[model samples]
Target chain A: MTYTAWILLTASLVGLSCGIIGVFLILRRMAMMADAISHTVLLGIVTAYLITRELSGVHMLVGAIIAGLLTAVLVQWFHSRGVQQDASIGVVFTTLFAIGVILIATQVGNVHLDVQHALMGEITFLPWNTIHLPVIGDIPKATLMLIVVFLVVLAFIIAFYKEWKITTFDAGLAASLGIPVVLMHYVFMTLVSITTVASFDAVGAIMVVAMLITPAAAAYLWTDRLSVMLVLSGAFGVISAIGGYYLAVWIDTSISGSMAFSTGILFLVSFIFSPNHGLMSRVVKPYTTTE
Target chain B: MSVLAVRDLSASYHKNKVLYDVDFEINQGSLTGIVGPNGAGKSTLLKVMLDLHPKLSGSVVFFGKNLSQTKTRIGYVPQRGSVDWDFPTNALDVVLMGLYGKIGWFKWPSKKDKALAMASLEKMGMADYANRQISQLSGGQQQRVFLARALVQDADLYFMDEPLVGVDAATESAIMETLKQLKENGKTVMVVHHDLLTVEEYFDHVMLLNKTIVKHGRTDETFTKENVQATYGGALRWMKEA
Candidate 1:
């Protein structure tokens, strides 16, 4: 496969995984929490690097997941202590992300990690960091990690489909039915953390937030069924990845930024033109009415 | 047989006590109405019994066992407005959630589960709205859909939080009819109700509450004007004149 193909594949896989989890976040009205987790994960990455004296992908992922879970726990604790939901998220993520930024700025100088790569990402250079495998010979390490994360997320959703559905829709009901709703919630947050950490190097925090929310939001506008919405969001994510790759190549811009931009565009299209709930359909309904 | 027993139950939210040493026993195969004023902790009582709220001091037992041990025999219908109606789901899908516990982990809803959901929808007069998105349904229809979900549970004990609020007259009658059928099937139901006029008509038993149980017995014996005045306090004068 060409280098560009590998990059596009990595982008698509990231989108697919992020998109699936994004639907649940949107449904639970925690899309901003995704943004919060992605930002706070930088703290985890830097802390791991500081401790291990290495910048391996596995170490960074572990660090980021821990940081993400901490963010969720702190937010919940604040909310329980009478702080508002958005306020708790805002306070936690900003403080942690600020610490992460300061650490990278002052301590990680001369290392391969830098502020620019942390913020904007370096998807173009992903193919250069290849890992040799038994059968595939060599593949980008990001692609392999993303594939594993994607499979894990897929298995989780399938295994706990009903639990997630009931919990997202009505947590009180889920609890009354003995579904262990709180445990399911933590498990879900852990998956979201994993997805955010895996997408760190490829899409960066900004695009991770974008992919984790926009496509799912777009799918929401198109369908009133959770199953269909999940499928549509996955499709929208892959389409945006492919479309964004070409658009980036054409315009000579950041691939992740272009992909995130495409997701926003797709969401706008759905907002305007969705069959049942779109603005256009509502506006045209009165004129089309014959009764 | 007692389906539920609550002893010395007390609960608070943010340091403000809501329920104070509440005690009640609900017998099997009876429809009981929990009635009280706006801040009288009627809903809090149900929540406390279900262990959904933090109890300052209490013990709730279900059929001689703890809640966790007897959860499969219990069903819940939350308030109509508590859920997001715009959630991306049809009525049938919401109804199918009743079987999630019975279906257990790592499994999908079987055909039998879907059929039971459909039958429950039909029982609540919501069969026509099975595929309709929940947000598009009328307020009364939405309430019926929730009722159907509870029906599909086939539980021995059901706790419904204001199932009749904001619903149409037909829907109210439909819900009452279903509750009657549940009673006929030897199932126990406790409803948090607001309409004082329908207490005698709807429930065989009534528990008037005001931070505690003021009266609890057969509706004919306990749902008197004095008990209501004690339950509602200043609010009962207007009710009396009406």
Candidate 2:
């Protein structure tokens, strides 16, 4: 496939993965954790490169996961200790992200490490270093990695759907019934970490939050069932991805930002127009009659 | 034999202690009503027994085993307001959570589990509203859904916090019927009840508490005007008498 084709395929995969996983994150009320993880992951990657003297994807993956877990732990610890969760997440992640920016600026002198690229990816150039497999032909390595991450995330959700549902809905009741609510919560945080790490290279940090939360929130507007919400969110994300790429090319804008902007627009539309529990429904309720 | 035993059970919210070294024992098949004024730690004590709250120093034994060890044998129904009713799950979904503990992790509820949950909901007269979203349910129906969730545990012991708080007369009767059935089936039930009038009618045993146990015994012996005065205040005693 051509370079443009490769970028398109990879972007689509990333969108699908983010949407599927984002549904649960939103339902669990940990949407902000995605934003937190994406920010802190820059530090993980930079720190790992400093220690290992290599920029291998695996090293960055390990670093990002560790950093994500640490962020989640700090957030929960602060919450348990009576600190407001949003404040703790904001403080912890901003400090880590600042440290990363300093490291890149000071040490990585040969590399062009701009904040713009760190925040939003340059997807147009990603197809230049495509890797070829025997049966699969030439493929964007990042796309393949994203596919694996997607499969892992889907497996975890499908396997532990009941546990996740129960714990998110009523944790105290689940714990009393011996469901190991804490363990399940940690496992969920780990999954979010993995998802954040998997997508950071392609979508970057700022847009990654959009991919994690926008589709999920949009899906939330459309459905009451968790299963339906998951499927709908994934579909919405893919549509946003394809549409955003073309819009970016037409408008001569950044692909990542365009994609996030499109996703955000969809969220706003859903917020206003959704039939059940939408802002528009509430506004129009007094004038409407129910049969 | 004591079906449930609590020793040196103390609990606190942040810095302020709510339950201090309070201890109690409950026998099998007993309908025990934990009656107390507001802020008397009745709910906290139940939370302690269910290990929902952190304990400063305590141990709870159930059916000759530690409470932790016997978790599967206990059902817990927290207060109606304890949950976010705006959640998107349906009534049946809530009840199916009871089977999650038994099914363990990475496993979905099976056909057999659904049948069991449905049966429990039927017992609570809520089978027809199985697919109804929790937010749409009335206050009494909401309470019934929570009770049905506990009932699906099929536990040997049940801990219910204000199961009758906002329940209608019919829902209350339905809940009382389930509680009576549980007692008949050799299950011990500890209820945190607020209504003073129904204490004698429903409970076989009563524990009057005001941060500490003022009196505990059979309903006829312990739930007297004097115990009410000691536990709550003189006003409650006068109200009970008049």
Candidate 3:
């Protein structure tokens, strides 16, 4: 209805999709790979924009998925060749991101591609880029794209929940059960790429990284059940998005940055105050038991 | 008929050869123990056989078919420590994974699967702890949980890597009893074991390995001190003298 509502809805959906996928990456110990995909997908976006001379979502999605898959492949290639995993991810992402930055500066300068906005998004301006449909005329394109991505991600999670759980927990056993672990891995990376692309305009690269990891990490501190953790992570992400929107409105700052800050705060609270695994529980257990 | 047949299986890690031309055939309904010293390729041989690791040269058949064709009939219990215990799942959830293959794609486990998993956990004395977070379990309890998971597979053949390592006496005996039960059901089981003293006591068939098969036959005939020395090499020659 309202512009602010649209922006907030898009932000919340972005956070929700990222947070859901973040749970798997966090469990698989591939949070760094998420970071890698978010950064490297920039190269794909820049490449697509340069060639098409249009900021079309389809081109961006295709390019981002390709680049993201390449990053995963190269990282695995390096790892298989004896390079350490984190190091491989570090090398691939930084190199591709650097190339993206250079391309943006030199080649895409004529386009309306602001480097600052690419790193830290301008969520306030998201409502300006609107698309008209039959009855629901004048909807923000970013909102529509993120809503679609969110639903697709949710469907993927529901359909493959068992496979994801098995593969993330024990890949060797998953393979032994004929679970096609490598195919699942690639599909997961592709989803990560899609989410990063969808959220790029709303949260930018840096904040996407925060949204992808922080809420899920916070949920992890709160629960030991995967099902509960997924629901809690989604709730945390939405809370961060809506709360950050108001905080941004009050402080007159970047909405994405404020949202990311809120996620960080939630994670810190969970880290200290979670009933089971928190630092406060650890510290209070001995005194309570003695008393 | 042999439940498992490995013909001239060779495997390497990086450039270093781990398993040399290893040949072995395991009969159906037998409990076999693979014993060797560290770096003797006991684990590698099993991994290579299951095609978990790439083989330099090998052909392994299970029940007259390739692994892919016979995967549904095979169950695996990886080393207890190999997985992340902090994973956000309870013992029951982990055990339920064994039923995923049978349940097939795009379908959730039904009440029957849960009941089956519960029964397997009960067999391992882990029924009461099914809902406990895996990370909170003791080392022995964790091992039992994994054993229960493998048991839920209801496989015709099972491969377990060091399932008894770090387990308590009670857990160890429970696992041994379960293995005996599996054999009684006419299921084939191959385990990578470390304890020399329990080799004869645990397995009906024993294969001593050191980059290759040094001795393999019925446990009573092949598990002599000399075979143990040969498997362990000069580092453990005192075993033979003793």
Candidate 4:
């Protein structure tokens, strides 16, 4: 029931969710798109607050999902038009984010969300906001959201393992097989959006991208199968989340940054040590006599 | 019966016309070679026939129904390089994709589906490479894997885009055998082929195309020098060995 314990619980759950969705982002080669989606959610948050003049968590989640879907659609449109896909994504999302920044600067006179808060999140301060559940007693609302999202993503992947795997591997092939490739793609981007927005309140904008990409990229080094990638990415995310929490506690700085740092370090380690794709592993392969 | 039909099919990319008023029909239990020179819209025609291109204007009918309605009755093997060969998936996993339409969403491949995929791999001489990552495959192995994927569809019609490109002679022979088998089983096999030399040997019917169909008939008739000249803009004469 300590604040520190609450922080660790929240970080671990959110990290788990990020890792789960990160697998698809990595598969789709949309790491930068995921980064763009995280930023655009800030705009959505600002726009929603301006319209409703309220700060409810659910409202922010809804707004963020809409903005996230829009960003994905824009990326697809540009890519299909024969434009350079990544640069178009960068241009579209950053423009929306700049608008959000200006809105927050000029319009929000009293809200606690400033540029600094959006960049470096406050996990230590998250424990005090109580959402009391009748069965579970008092828990941080962000922790509860993270748990729900993680379970939903886990169930979705488990249920649609064949469809997701096929689409990730070859979208045209999946479409030819009548698997509704476009619809599945939109559904995935929606989940990524939800994860990014949810993490916005916990890990902030920049660090959420780190969690979304790093764990999955690290898992990429380890496996060539969707099932294995999903499991390994989730594990990597959870470890980084816990490790980052402690590192932040020791360093006396931001918890989200520490989580991102830990994820980056894990990615580097996997890049070197992964059996099939790792640099050091390949270099050491000729000398090893096991084969 | 003609299992597939296309009428007045015109397609363009960014306002540049690729396929123009092209019409074709594919009967069941036949192998049709669609041959054309470079930039002759061979791939574009196949894509339009499969209803994959939205900019295409045409009617693609299968079994007397619209293309969308006949989706489950058709299998497609795109170009071997159309996707990232380095994608993190194995050969068996790729083959299993053909069963997705029949199995529907959120459903696992049944035991029968796995059996079918394995059988298809074995048919293509790729059963031993079932667990190997697709990128680890040679060009011929990659083509055979694609053929296996199509075979697992168990559909009435098959469309393969340059299935023999970059493949070794042995792989080419394997693919020809598989296509011949599909034809014998009463499936229509339409291949977007580039090489003219194999047209006489591999296909029973031929369509010589250069932005349009200049000739389509039995292979021996349609593979004549004049039709080949028209399809290749007189370039075929030089490429041919006397």
Candidate 5:
């Protein structure tokens, strides 16, 4: 595979995994929480590095999961205690992310970790980082991780389709019918955390939020069926991946940053041109163009 | 024998007490209406019994078993406003959620499940709108679809929270009709109702509540004006005028 092919595949997988799980985040109205979780996981990564003295995928993921869940629990606790929702999210993420920054500045002495890498991922290095496997030979580590993460995401959706849907749509009904609403909530959050860490290297921290929320939000405008919406979310993410890659190369810009920009652009286009719920429909609704 | 029983049920949110020592029993086939003013724990009672909220102290038994044990025998119709209408599912699909328990975990709904859901929608006069997205339905139509979903549960007992708050008269009559049919078929149904004027007319058994049960029994005897005033107290001038 050429250098461009590997980078595009990795970027596409990052977009696919984040975009698919992200439909739930958008539907559950937890998009803001997704952003918070993405940022706060940096704290988990830094703390794990401090303890382990080396950054490994498995260890970093475990740390990210623990930190992500902690942030979720803390945000929920504060909101339940009569604190406003946005305020709780803001306080928890900012405090935890600040701690992560402090740890990185103090402890990560001469280490390769830096805020710039975490924020705007250097995707040019993606092709060079290869892992040799038994049958597939040498594959980029990001590609391998993302492929596994994407499959798990697909399995989760396939296996728990009804449970996740009913819970997101109506919690009381889900609980009454013997579904463990709280447990299901945490389970889906764990999936999001996994997707976040898997996609983090390709999209970085800030852009990961864009990958998770933007494509799904854009797809949400086009379809009234969740199954179709899921497919569209992944497709749009791939489109952004493909489009942003060319844009980045053409302009000599950051690939992840360009991809995030593409997602925003797609969202804007969807917001205006969506057949059913778009601004065009709103304006032309009274005219009722019967075609 | 009573189909449902509650004893010493209390639930609190933070430092505030929502329900305290609320106890009640409903006989089999009783169409009991759980009524109270705002914040009287009407919804909280159902939520606690269903384990949606953490209970401070309570005992809820359905058919001589705990909630998890009798879950298949239980169904719930949450408030129409409880769910987002723009949930990207058709009316039939929403109704299909009713049978999620029976379909078992990790298994897709078969043709039989879809037929059951369609049948349930037909009962609510919603068969024609089955394929339509839920967001396109009218307020009353949406309530009817919700009732259809609960019907698909086919449970021995059902609990509903404020199913008639903003629905039109047609939906009100449709829901009341279904509730009556459920009772006639020997199913115990409990509704969290808000309208005080329709208590006696709509329910055979009534539980007038204000953080606790002011009265619980046959509506003719328990739903008297005095009991209602005592339950609502001066907090409701609307009831006084009525």
Candidate 6:
């Protein structure tokens, strides 16, 4: 496969996984919280690497999950203590992310990760880091990780469609009917952690936020059905990846940055042009039939 | 004969005591109205019994067993404003959520489930609006959808929070008719109601509560003006006559 194909594949998977979970995050008004989880997992990764002095996948995964959940808990704790919820989210992520930056700057000497790499991501060079597995032969390491997370997300959506739907829609009814509301919440946070860390290597910390929320928000304006929203958001993710790849090549710049930019463009277009819920539609309401 | 029983049930929100040592019970085939002032613990009491809120120290028995043991025979219509109406789903889909407990969790809804949901929507006179986005529905329509969702549960006991608030007269009558039908069918329903004028007419049993159970019994016997003044303190003026 061509390097371009591999890059698009990696970026697209990031788009797909982040887009789906991001839908729930957007609907639940947890988009900011999801961003906070993504950034704090950086601290978890840095803490793991600082202690072990080795870039082990398991350590990073464990550290990221812990950090993600910790971020959620601390935010909830502060909110309960009378702090505004968004302010708590901002305070928690910024503090942890700063500590991670300080640790990486002062202590880490041999590690390949830097603050820039953690934030902006380096998707342009992901194609060459290929690993030879027995069954799959040679596949890019980032691509393989992306595939695993994507499948995990897909399987979760498939298996718990009703559970996820009910819980997100109304926790009280879900709880009354004997659904494990707390368990469902934590499990979803764990998925956000895994997806955030998984996309970390490809889209960086910041663009992953863009990838997660932008496509989902755009899709939300178009459809009034959750099922349709999911599918459309996935398609928007692909559009961002493929279009952003071409844009990145044309400008000779950051692929992740271009992809994130494309998401914003898509969202802007949708916000202005969405038939039922867009700005243009409201303006044209008197002239057009809304059926 | 008791459908639900609460003993020494106390619950608090943070440092504030929301419900203090409340105790009550209801028999089968009863439609009980829980009436209280604005800050009264009427909603919290229902929440704690359903285990949606944590009880400080209490025992709540449903159908001679705990809530978990008898969950399938329970239905809840939480407040109409409890969920985001812009949730990208239609009325039929929302109604189908009631059947999830019966659908047995993690299992896809078959055509039978779809038909059940459709029938529930029809019962609420919302069959024409079944496919409409919930966000576009009127306040009364939204309440009807929520009731339809609870109706599909077919539970023996139902707990509805403020079902009449902000609803039109038509929806209010529809909801009252359904509530009466539930009682006629031997289903027990407890509603957190705010209006006091309709107390005697709408309910057979009334539980007047503030932070505690001030009075509880048959409406004619328990819903006296003296009992309501004691429960609401000076916070409530004269209730408006319908």
Which candidate tops DockQ?
1
Location of the lowest summed lDDT over 10 successive residues in candidate 4 chain A: A282-291
**Alpha-carbon error at A239 in model 2, in Å?**
1.2
Candidate 3: the clashing residue pairs are: none
lDDT, candidate 1, residue B190? Answer: 96
Instruction: State interface RMSD in Å for all models.
Output: 0.8, 1.5, 0.8, 1.7, 0.9, 1.2
Which regions of candidate 2 are displaced past 4 Å?
A: A112-114, A279-291, B233-237
lDDT of each: 0.91, 0.85, 0.91, 0.85, 0.90, 0.90
Q: For candidate 5, lDDT tens digit of each residue in A54-156?
A: 7767777888888899999999999999999999999999999999988999889788678887777778898888889998899988788889889999999
Label model 5 with its docking quality class. high
Model 4 ranges with Cα > 4 A deviation: A287-291
For residue A73, give model 2's deviation from the true position in Å.
Answer: 1.2
Q: What is model 1's DockQ versus the real complex?
A: 0.85
Of candidates 2 and 1, the better by DockQ: 1
The segments of candidate 3 whose C-alpha lies over 4 angstroms from its true place after superposition are: A285-291, B237-242
On DockQ, the stronger of 2 and 3 is 3
Calculate DockQ per candidate and list them.
Answer: 0.85, 0.66, 0.84, 0.67, 0.84, 0.78
Instruction: Return the lDDT, model 2, position B77.
Output: 92
TM-score of 2: 0.94
Q: Model 3 Cα displacement at B121 (Å)? A: 1.0
Shift of residue B186 alpha carbon in model 5, Å: 0.5
Q: Which residue pairs of candidate 4 clash?
A: none
Error of 3 at B165 (Å): 0.6
Query: Once model 3 is optimally superposed onto the true structure by TM-score, how far is the C-alpha of residue A94 displaced, in angstroms?
Result: 0.9
Quote the lDDT for A103 in model 4. Answer: 93
Q: Write the residue-wise lDDT of candidate 4 on B131-227 in tens digits.
A: 9988888999988988988988888988889999999999989889888988888889889998877889999999888887889989977788877
Give model 4's TM-score versus the native structure: 0.96
Tell me model 4's lDDT, rounded to 2 decimals: 0.85
Better of 1 and 2 by TM-score: 1
